[model samples]
Target: MPDTSQKAGGRRNAQSRREDQPMYPATLKVAVIHWVMLCAVASTVAQTVDLSGEWRFKKGDDASWRQPDLVDTDWQPISTGSPWEQQGHPDYDGFAWYRRRFTVPTALRDAEAFALTQSLLLSLGRVDDVDETWFNGQRVGGHGTFPPNYAGDWQAHRSYVVPNALVRWGEANVLAVRVYDGSGMGGLLGRRPLLRAATWREVVRLEWEPGLGDGLFTAPRPIAFQATLHNDSPRALSGDLHWSVEDDEGKELSRSTVAVALPAGRATPAVHSFQPSSPGFYKFVATLEPVDGTKLLFSKFTGYLPESIEAPLTREPDFDAFWKETLATLAAVDPQFAVERKIDRDSATHEVYEIAMRSLGGVRVRGWYEKPKTGNRSPVLLRVPGYGQNMRPTGSDAPIAFFSFNVRGHGNSQQDVSGLPADYWIRGLDDKRGYYYQGAYADCVRAVDFLAGRSELDPQRIGVTGGSQGGGLSLATAALDPRISLCAPNIPFLCDWVKYFKASHWPEMDKWIEARPERTWETTLKTMSYFDTLNMADRIRCPVLFSLGVQDPVCPPSTVFSVYNRLGGRKEFRAYPNDAHRVNGAHRAVLNAWIGREFSRPAK
Candidate 1:
């Protein structure tokens, strides 16, 4: 129940840093930085300056703003590392500019001192969407393709070399940044931007791969920890790389060091194998110290368990009885089905209909339905969406019927109450019967009923698919209703609630717990047991195709793997290394192929 959707802000000032504050001093803030850096090699430069505080900020972009002499009399002050939305410009999107002035340290202002460093480089951490950066009066760097056909690399850290000839040895230098955020959180997000020496760099890249390649490791089975070091400079580099494996609670399980050497433009990877004696998730971290005192670090999260997950099914004995009663109450209500055709959204291959249905508690749920114009009945694809997202037709011209359904309090179904996601997930937490998702889950079942009643659809071939919250809903629907024959839930939420509260970085659920500190963890978890997807995994008998990212912080791999291990039906899973919440094209291809095979199979 943690709030995982918080906007990306200053890395050192973000959740990770706050969590480490109790252990490290302000001067040793770099200790926390060591844990967050994944593959970036730390530069050898010993002397560097951090650029993380207030800067002149403006909402819109201007060409002249990049000029060094431009005065920002009206521009407001904002942090360089936090998103603008999280600050004061919550509603503002599109282009924005950030400007700041800093003079070379008076001690390093000498030309000889500058010559020793050769050329200076600027590290801009990571920017959301797209960005163009300027130093003094010249354009220095740009990341992500810009405008017209814009695609921002939200995860990349920007590091650019500043030309030596343009160095203002003794005078003040100005840095300007232009940014564009398409959706959600925007602006410069990541570690503090800094000025560093562009000398020899040492980077440590680490990955923990299970022998099964499934992102889940069995106890007593050896897991490979692969580490690679890259030398960015055009010279040979050598250093001592130290690595350690730690439990989820931060206890070091194993530690060792390796001497690594890399020629120019070369990478040296070393594999270290370790066998876990216990079950749980562990963090593998590698640290490399270049010539500088600063430590470069990289880490990967891995889980180890028995062939069977030890996660207990923490459901109440009344769980089935409670759901059966709710369904009975829902069945008594008559769903008045109505459809509105969206001609503009329709194509020659398929017709789009905006359909509405009456669900539990008499709430109206809405969905966009698409079916092949062919008269023959086709398999149906019921898609539930991620948290707070409105459902829209997928518009795939494949030979199948599709329904993008929105549950109560979502999209057009928000008649009874607005589904502000932050509030929706934990609504009515104290009581099981009044929980919000009870209605949401009922809406999904009603959607299946609606599909069963349709003459143009095959009830036997009904399938459910979704990601994140939708993925959890897919499992719930398939477990509760036997009508669902196929299920594909990607990076599902709502699994292992008690364990999730401790393993994830999300803090939303913590807010409710903080407000009611009087409520014991046991009581809170008991209420959550009725809704935990881990409790529902065993009830699903349909064939399932599940996918997840190993580095997903929102839905940790341990929790997802627990659900995977508990499935009582035929199931296949795909896992990606170093990926977060989203899946790549190859994973999508696998999912599409799986769905195609299921749809083309002979009906029972």
Candidate 2:
């Protein structure tokens, strides 16, 4: 069995929390202030000045660039809203400098609340690679270390606090930034930058939690997506807590406003009941605002009984007939399955073979097959590849057999597919019969056929698992062929196409629609209906273990849920709230042991 000591304590159904993962905090902070109000808010009123605009830029770094009054006659103009690469230096990298001039209103020095604080907050959105900033020729703040260390996370937000004494109020002041990018797109980017008094977090703090500890609420049970609002100030405050529940597509399902009175220095619980008629993911957004207009906002995601969420089949009437005919066509061609031993790569415990066979439309696919040298029949696991990815033999020392298969257009299996990934998605979009995945799915079926025919493998104990596009392929393969005894998919694609389009964008999808003069979106979706995983979920009766990253944009959590909620029989899912399009090391250990245990069980 795979080692369980890595993480999640190797628990079979652990939803591991990756709290350390960085999330891009909303940098657009309105005045975090105490307000002079007819009602009440904070004791300080925060005024903000937007500093996001065109800035003088240079490709190379120089210590002299930080001067407040340098004649930057030849420096190019660049906007802070986007990376420098997108402006004019698409291929340029390394050190760069950005400078701009602005005034911090002198009137702020006379404001009643201004005397309460000693610093002004500069919100710089996000910077790629690394950045160092200077306000009026003095080092202020920066994130990441410059080379030879060369370490910086592009995702982190950039915020600097400037001492109140440094401000040359109502006078022209220069702000300069030094940036270094090792490679890829780089520069100041993301949200609009601003110079504000403070952020809402500096005063009051807000946090959300589901009513049920596991966040799975039964239908009509009156569940609450509750929030704890803490009043950090010594004085009391009053406000209306507005709560809204949104569906997976961002459609507002319900809203409520409750007046809250906070006692001095105490945390108050804000809650509202939301009843979901069906199972699916939902988001809760809360805004606590007083009459003075100081607002603190926070959001959290949760789901109901996921398996009970109903998504009706959007398949065409000929869905079964279409696949039946495709398989028949594949059956007409001889597989010509062949395997050759690789003596040099064989481990002490197993032997390896380079395998290939003819699949649908006579497209030849390739894979690596390895078996233990115990001279006993072994349960084989089929591992598929992600989009445009090739397959390499895994170096695992497990006793089970492994068949790493690559479809046409991926890795060594590309015999007919030209171009690359973008071309593959749009190819033959007008006709379902000619679509690339039609043959690719058939290629997976042929691999299973080859496995069942092998004497050294137990056909009844076969399993399939993959991530991203491969995750979708595993679902399709298991649905079409019963030989797969266990199925595990992670951050999967090819499910729920209609919602998929709404949640994520693939340029190839746009290109396909634009190139064809007669093809409308309705017609295009009809073709996709034939391949959507939700329509085929009921066909696979085997137990399924699925995982998804809540932050994954490529194959979003919504797309995973559209199909996952419809899955019947034995199934469970683990969501990594902070991950994006990839599985964690802890989940990997869990899968290893789970798969090992599943394969070793008695097959029905």
Candidate 3:
């Protein structure tokens, strides 16, 4: 497949955000972020009232139920997140009424103590079908339509602005929701309902220079951004604005503070200019603490010269020898291969089987295999699974055969070991030989051997692919076994172990390390180096196609590049800038095409 690139990114004010990159005509070729953030603000003004949990519910709707004075003591208590069908209504749909009573604390209604505006947004998440919402006997807003020429969308989320007068501020208030579902699930069906104050997103339109890209740039050129406030309120607002640009490591490179006033009913623009000294990812943050309005926060992540990113190499001197000896030692055991053809799963177009084989420690492992029924010998794709996931038989209609292999400690291979514990990453941290991945990697190689043993499978055309942990296994399998001809890894984990811990964090990962006195990060990472894909990247010579989520906190793109940049083979990658750990369907389409195109070539 030809290398592909296009526009993609996600954004929200001050929340874990993605930035839009602007196209720059300057010869410097840097992507202008058009975003900046405020830092070290004295205060931010906002309030959130959680309205989730149990609420009074009834099977049928009554117009009087919307009244605040109605006594609903006999109504059933039902949770707001799930549909009424799941809360015991069964297939019964049509109309239902939900009522909840809450007290708005005086703290949230104060409009004069430093913060002037206390606008309320009642977020009911996404409700199936249509709903008419009421607060304290007053119809605030609603969504879709009901009956007579019925038209409503299940995908439409419910957010309604509440007028200050109806809130019964600092007093008890009653909320009611009248919903109608023509079929299937009904009632509030997504996130819990809540009321939150409007943030910077409501008052500002942040514009970056050259509006073509989002969160990607070139190095050595100054980054430019400006924040504009809409100031649509009744009076002019004055507040302190704090802004800064920081590197990926959270180190502040530039920062400044200033007091600014925004004129009412107009747009006010505040622009800033700065340049990053080197290539990599940088973040811009801005905060607006309006003296009498809601506090707004902003952050945008941008990348510069990402291709030049380099990670610290921690490969042990005996890394190659360590793996060579282990493989040699494990090969001494008989594989004890077994295959059971599942007649029940077979079709005219494909043959299905449950297969097993022995790997390190003579431990037996299992996987699901499905081969095309054609007599022609075809290339095989060894499919792998992500961390702690169970994989079913891949019935992909693609030209090649698919073997969904599971390493020990996963799926049906739990006979020898099980990934039952959540803290698998930290298990066996003391010994390199005992680490969970040591045996898992060997299990992948053993699967390759099993694939090669099949007379109908083209060993020279075998390709390995998966996401997350499976992605790491794909690279490791190719690195350890010369039989693998093509490798495709997406958002791969288990690379650049030291950096992985720094870029992302998990409560389980931290608790495990903190629980033991002898476990130092230095010693743990030293052992991890043996299985590090970055250390093994140079050994693989097959064509490699990598896809990454640039915003992935689990398997940082920088760490993925450390392995990609070091590969001693033909390699190309497609990046999704806004993704966290998983690449979406966009990458999957490219991967399928890339696999089909690469496998068509003669064996190297």
lDDT of each: 0.73, 0.74, 0.72
* Cα misplacement distance, residue 498 of candidate 1 (Å): 2.0
The numbered model that scores best in TM-score is 1
Cα lDDT of model 3 by residue, 19-114, tens digit: 111111121122122221121121133456778877998978689999999999999999876767667887676888989999877677653421
Clashes of each: 7, 5, 14
Q: Tens-digit lDDT track for model 2 on 1-604?
A: 6321111111111112221121111110111122225112332245667777778999887999999989886999988867676688865679999898888897666554444334566778777769999998888778777988666555567877666657898998888999986655578874467776644444466755663544545556756667788664445778888889887677899988889888755789877778886666677888788624567677776766655655567899899999999999999989998899998768666688989899988888999887778989988888887776666565456777888788887777877665253356567878999898898899999999999999989989888988788889999999999889989887888888888887655555676688768988899999989998988888888888888876566676767877877767688788765456765434665677788888878988
| Best of the two (1, 3) by lDDT | 1
Instruction: Give the range of the ten consecutive residues with the poorest summed lDDT in model 2.
Output: 23-32
Model 1 agreement with the true structure over 166-211: per-residue lDDT tens digits: 6686678899988887654678875578875564332223334443
Scored by lDDT, model 2 comes in at: 0.74
Off by over 4 Å in 1: 1-220, 235-238, 259-264, 305-307
TM per prediction = 0.69, 0.62, 0.67
On the 0 to 100 scale, the lDDT of residue 432 in model 3 is: 91
lDDT leader = 2
